[model samples]
Target: MHQLVATPFGGRGLILRPGSTKAVQLPLARFEELRALASALSTVPQWLIGPVRAQWNVDLTSRSVGDAILVREAGPYEFSRATWEINLGCDLDCSICYLGEKKFEGLDMDGKRKLLAVMRDAGVIWLQITGGEPLIDRDFPESYQIAHEMGMLLELLSNGSRLRKPHILNLLRTFPPAKLTLSVYGATAETYDTVTRRRGGFDRFREGLEQAVDAGLNIDLSLIIVQENAHEVEAMRDWARQLGVPYREYANISPTIHGTAEPLPSQSPQYLTNRAPFTGCPAGVTFFHADPFGRASICKVGREPNIDLIAEGVEGLTRLGGIAESLMLRTGGCSGCKLSDSCRVCRPMAKVFQEAKAPLVNYCQHGMR
Candidate 1:
């Protein structure tokens, strides 16, 4: 096991071992300083240096400690983080689900364990367990425990409906995720129910949030901006503030994983129209996603399977680097467009539009301009 684990927030911290109970928090800079001092001293015990050297893949003789730990570059086949879609069986039929009305089929417990092992061996440090609703997965408790035992920093992304259940709450208390991100659809029952189209979703969400807080779990609230819930955005923020929980707003909506624009209608047009320069995408490079069936892709939005992780294993991930490189290159009409300067459009979506020539009016705001 690695002596120093990377936190989800991008800092390095020590997880005390040898029958230890908890992680010891440390700042990145300070951890680096200790590592440097330890590396320089020949008198330091081998037991102390062994784990750090193995974890960072340090060459003590040739490379400086600063150089070794400063930047972590992933090899072609390696990934730092992975998002595993445990199941697609969400209880609430929200107006803006990226997967739309997808059928839910997940790996059996044994298969799931194998997949987790593959990810761990492939060097995934942070594993995000997401779903239509992760807590609803019948095998979630065992799966969560297995991942935790494998030394992966886990993040649970859920609608927070089932989290109110005693069994689920107990599971969280026993092996807490590094972070629990709950999706808040609206500020009140009326607005939330309107978006979810489920009668008691808001109540269940509230109850779940309370249960998680009572369990002393780290919680983050994410508000999805859509036509039904846009009016209550500020109120939702205020509610998160009142609860003293960190909150963020997601205004951008993407097409379904199947390449259909089902959720596009629910998106706020004003939000789509606002443009920014195209920064780089991290998909297939530092991050990857695996669907319920173990098909791997660069991201959720770009669900063109680059590999079948269940069949190919780590070798398949190497092919993703070339795929990622190709996806980043400009395609079709995007190559010489005047609006390219301020385009916020991503390459995958651009490729979709280019091939179809379908005027995704909201997505192609620059075209209208």
Candidate 2:
């Protein structure tokens, strides 16, 4: 049996056996049996028989740590999951950008180690690097290299403003295409500038996209829907279609956790009303978010640490009531709602419990009537 050790960020994971260790995809594609295996072996008491067990070595080196203690809590990956934040810093001053006020400690190389360790330990196969704009970071490439080295899939979420630079374009060509995701704010300069609040942003974004496309890089586009650009969604979709890539709109949510000074005015009714049926939020389940400081928790938007990535490890994450129970305790308004399938509240709503000193809320889900 292989032992699993967790890395720093609750992402990245590694599996270790007697003489060999290698990276394993995370969230463990076949986790149901893992627990049973652990249970079956638990009776043997690892300390009493660990050395004997070492004779049956396998080759899997986890990214988190060197050979040390046996870690039983690890998982492999589930492709549907992806992390979308690279750094908190961004150049665009869009009115809706919620992370603007938050302070970025500036993730350094060591932090990258923690991040890589976590993702590798978690078996997170794909990481989506995002930020104010990832290209602005001088160490962006270094971070990319680490993910690539760990064999984790990579995707970059950027404003596409830096693509016009030949050097930047050249640098990007070194990576695999299946691992990148880009953000295009608008289909045209007028619309782009309106959303970015920068006069030349549209042209820059377009120029960058052109460069990326020319380089034959794999890219996905994300659009933020707002009053000004709501109508542009179809146009942007058509443009993405022309590029032979997929595009989607994400409603603007406040960046309170990123340390932004003020949350974007609670998402507008229009945006909220149009939300698609909720999938009960996959936080702490298929995917989890970590605070800049390496704290792991149920939701990226929630900010506070419901679970600590560094201390708990993968086993800790599962022991914390598992995802389903944790979601019930951490989420709001799940008491008597028949429309649970349509509710969109996340950890932020958990605040209702925190503020009222209650365990949960009494509200009904959408379509309660």
Candidate 3:
């Protein structure tokens, strides 16, 4: 039988075995040591140390009284969360956009249905829609309705260009979004337009956001920091505060890697990415991404195909399951991180690259407090 044992010393530590739970407080120095140990364990056979490692930081264990545990061959698995790229097309061409150099073609309804069928079969209960602009896809609301009808929770990431259209806003209102993440290019039009490379974008984004809030959607701000606007962090954060929404800052990854819509030099690693590698990436575990290109990835940016949901269908996902893989991958840059307890590493990044990979450096490495 297996059980879960978490000790406070490890800051959200998990030990598998049958036993009662207790808490322990250690000096910050000792806590750091435990964090390192946990990060290391992420690389090896975590299951052998206890029971199965589930996704989203869940540790699955069997009890002497529970069902028999079966060991099976490893294969692609079903998805828990699905990312639907409505349109590869975007209105703005940012120099640092990860998908900027990539094409922004929209997905047809048939493609959307095929992807949804795959997700439905995989028992994916959650869906996140993103794009050059999801609103650019005429059938987006229909797609959302399909996912909602299938009982999947929905999250949307948009640039806020189309929200000014009452019908579009009405369509958006169809789903009580679990969360709506609006990308904030800058605090002011000059800064915002510069990043989005679009004229009058700040106005549209602001108006759309107000409508979204008026529609009673849970809003979150997504900010991308670059050399040009890095200093605007406080200002951007203040804007989010004014909107009464939480903000998440994403460092730019190499845009060339994803073949975005426009040609832009890759941002420097100093501002391009974060150093706090989350040990708990939700890939294969709790989430997965299916792009319009007919490729399914463990993460969003890279289109590495673990399975083709379009071809093999969602059943192909179960064949390439996630929990086990997530456990095997070490949390990068998190080797000696202090936020282990609260920080969940980018599972998608860790899964694609090794813990020792150079890009794993997170914010901690940049001297950010």
Candidate 4:
């Protein structure tokens, strides 16, 4: 497992450690020095070592410099981040899951390896490994290990269903993610199980969270507020606070990637949170999302025009910038709206809501206000 990573991103150098969000800026001179000592585990001078230890308590004493400390050369692609959905298969069947069908399908081990290589070569410095539940995938461990080996900072998104398992816990302990985010449906068993529509789900979730916390893994909680569990939102917030991990609340539910309205009924309209106005986003420009089959899209929410990274390879990404611009054009149902300047949702999101025939209040400022 790599203890620390040193890489160039966005015209600057960064030194990052596993299981920690703190990053140390690597000077051009020091960064080039490590690049020169490519084959040898040379001694790290005190000038550089002192601050790293202070920030993350990582000692460079016995660790290999050239090997343990992964040093990656800057790549041609300007992309510094990506999100990959390993598989849509999830353990629980939640009523409001954005991934409507939650089908269990994806690439084989070889294809997955190829996709990760493409991400690395494209300069994806920060990667989020997610799924309906990524832990359930058989190839997840190896895929994660491979990405970590290639010097990408990893973050995981899961439902906390399998975090208690010895195998999953041990794997995480060995090669820690920079952050692990889990979705919290409710604070108690009855509300939790009702929302998930699965028996004993709350018990399993609590156990998993306990084990993960005990293992000292970096964790973030996502408080999911839906109609089934809306009454328990405060209880959920209190539980997350007591657990002492960082958390954020989400009340807005959306249509599926295919623009279906199945998940809309699960939303609690009265409990919805206010949304900020839509602004320009750097989706295809700086970051992209890869689905299970390795098709790269501008982002998860904007999926229509995508690149087949598997068939065309990294060079195909060049077309995405134009695709993003075309997709962002406000010429659909939103074309001449007087409030288009302050609309809360982006074009891709509004298009899906329109497809789902959702109530305008859900996304349009005209109805909402």
* TM-score per model over all chains: 0.78, 0.64, 0.64, 0.96
lDDT of 4: 0.88
- Per-residue lDDT of candidate 4, residues 1-369 (tens digit): 567888986556788987788898977787888777645657665666887888987788655577557888776777888999999999999878888898989999999999999999998989999997999999998999899889898999999899888988998998889999999999899999998989999999999998898898999999999988888988988887888888998889999878889889988888786679987888998899999999999999899889999998989888889999999988778887888788898899999898899899888978866
Which model is ahead, 2 or 4, in terms of lDDT?
Answer: 4
Q: Give the best candidate by TM-score.
A: 4
Query: Model 3, 1-369: lDDT tens per residue?
Result: 112222221223232222111222335453344345444443223332233343223333322212211111112343456787777778877776656454766457898887776676665645788986888778887887786655455788888888889888886675466778888878888888887788999899889988888887778888877766666778998988887888898764442433332323334345554454444455655567777655677666435546776777756666344434644443644466555554433434333333223333432333444
Instruction: Evaluate residue 314 in candidate 1 and report its C-alpha lDDT on the 0 to 100 scale.
Output: 77
Score residue 135 of candidate 3 by CA lDDT: 81
- Candidate 3 Cα outliers beyond 4 Å, as residue runs: 1-78, 252-256, 259-274, 277-280, 322-369
Model 2, range 1-369, lDDT digits (tens) per residue? 113322312443333222122333335432333334344543322322333345334223221222322334434543224464556766677766656563455556777667667766675655666675777777777777776556555666678888888777876776543545676666778888877778998888888887788777867788676666776778988898998876766764544444443334433436544344445666666666655555555555554545555555555556333644445553443555555565555545534333434322222233333
Residue 172 error for model 3, in Å?
Answer: 2.0
Runs off by more than 4 Å, candidate 1: 1-77, 270-275, 333-335, 338-342, 352-361
Q: Which stretches of candidate 4 lie over 4 Å from their true place?
A: 62-64
For model 1, how does the per-residue alpha-carbon lDDT over 249-352 read when each residue is reduced to its tens digit?
88777666555666767887654545466777788887899888888888876677468888988778887777777777776667776666556778787665
lDDT of 2 at 157: 69
